[model samples]
Target: MGGLSDRFWNGAAAQLVNAIIAAVNARDFDALERYATADLLFCDSRGGQISGLARVIDWLRDVIAADPSFALQVDAVTSSNGSALVTGTTVSRFFPEARRTLWRLTFSGGRVSEWRRYSADPLPVPPPLTAH
Candidate 1:
């Protein structure tokens, strides 16, 4: 039931990432925390830092309020040893921009031990519309 590198463990970890994104988009914080470790550390592209699951929950709530149409797209997943890295882009309707991010997850005893987030670039400014 608790073995790293096993098919069950790997699949569960992958699903956890998916569930986290879904919960974030749906604004279901309670469900989001279920996949996070207690000491999770999240760093936003804007240089904001959120440490621990409790703080993450608060930060997410604020984000949902500010950006009602926030959505995440998982682009790739890579795993080795006991760690997995998920890369994706987040699209926000309020600001109408997109940013790429990588989420690193570490597993221990079939449970998430740590989760860290890093962004590849700042949210880009959309170009103004012009008619020919």
Candidate 2:
């Protein structure tokens, strides 16, 4: 938690991330219901922002049309308290480029309050500790 919010975020948050990812991959955004707060916010790496679930849905539909083959695969998840940093790859048959992606997610009351996509994975996971 790092003493951030009082909210508890861990495995459940990861699962929510995965579910959202799946919905995006399938282009079935209706599945995202109940996963986001009423005032959800979504932003792209380029600084474009979409507020509210309805706006987010419109933006996602546009994304799907522009990049039909774009897909995200989660490589790792680091979460604490109400925040999670997701590292993943985005590969598209249309683009044919393997790009590293970072998804920053914040949860509140078991639902996503904010989501941001970054073009790079900034925080590398540290090595595990050995017995002293």
Candidate 3:
């Protein structure tokens, strides 16, 4: 029974990842909206929060307008306890470099109720430690 449950969740999470990738690549705002709840909440690493589907759509549009070359390269997706954690790289046509980002999608009642994104800067190499 547990094995079946695990497979089921893994499949669902993969499906969700596929849907998101397709929607983003196609720039289909409707599909994105459908996958998310009406009162969806998106929180950025800076602690800024955007609530509601309409606002989220608007924000996404603005981002695309600012960076038309933006695309996602999903490295991995993992699901546990009804939430999916996506690790990926943010690729941009205009930018010369790719940025790393993590997305956490929380699902409820067949819709994503919350989405959190975390971005990071590459760490610098550490200096060699002296022998004691």
Candidate 4:
């Protein structure tokens, strides 16, 4: 049963990762909004202070707009206790560099309640953000 639960959770995490990559790459704000909790919290290592769903949406929009060259591809996903860890790599169109990243996500009512992004390789920073 534990294995079953683990597989289920890991699968869910992978699904969410796919949706996130697709939504963000496609610039589909509606999909992103639908997958989020009203009080969704995104904490990246980039160093910033913010709250509210609108702010999150704006932050995402800003990131997408600021770095069109950035792309993320999930390599693996593992989950336990309603939390999932995603191992991925960030690729860029213009730059020849690829950076590894790990994302931790907690779920509430099937939506992402909290999201944390960490740099796996080096320099734990997200793509780019325009200060608002």
| Alpha-carbon TM-score of each model against the true structure | 0.71, 0.78, 0.84, 0.80
Query: What does the lDDT read for residue 88 in candidate 1?
Result: 86
Residue-wise C-alpha lDDT for candidate 2, range 9-43, written one tens digit per residue: 55667788999889878887778766888788886
TM-score of 4: 0.80
lDDT of each: 0.67, 0.73, 0.76, 0.72
* lDDT assessment of candidate 1: 0.67
Sort the predicted structures by lDDT, highest score first: 3, 2, 4, 1
Misplaced by over 4 Å in model 1 are 1-9, 45-47, 94-97, 120-132
Q: Single out the weakest 10-residue window by summed lDDT for candidate 1.
A: 123-132
For model 4 the local lDDT of residue 68 reads 76
CA RMSD of all predictions: 8.5, 10.7, 9.0, 3.9
- Which residue pairs clash within candidate 1? none
Q: Which residue pairs come into collision in candidate 3?
A: none
**Tens-digit lDDT track of model 3 for 27-90:** 8989998898999888776556778878877777766777677777788888888899999887
What lDDT score is found at residue 11 in candidate 4? 83
How well is each residue in 1-132 modelled by candidate 1, as lDDT tens digits? 346546665676678778877887888877766776777766544555556778767766666666676677888776666777898877876444677778887776654666665765443332122233
Q: State in Å the error of residue 96, model 3.
A: 3.3
Per-residue lDDT, model 3, residue 109, is 84
Quote model 3's TM-score.
0.84
Off by over 4 Å in 2: 1-8, 120-132
> What does the lDDT read for residue 48 in candidate 2?
61
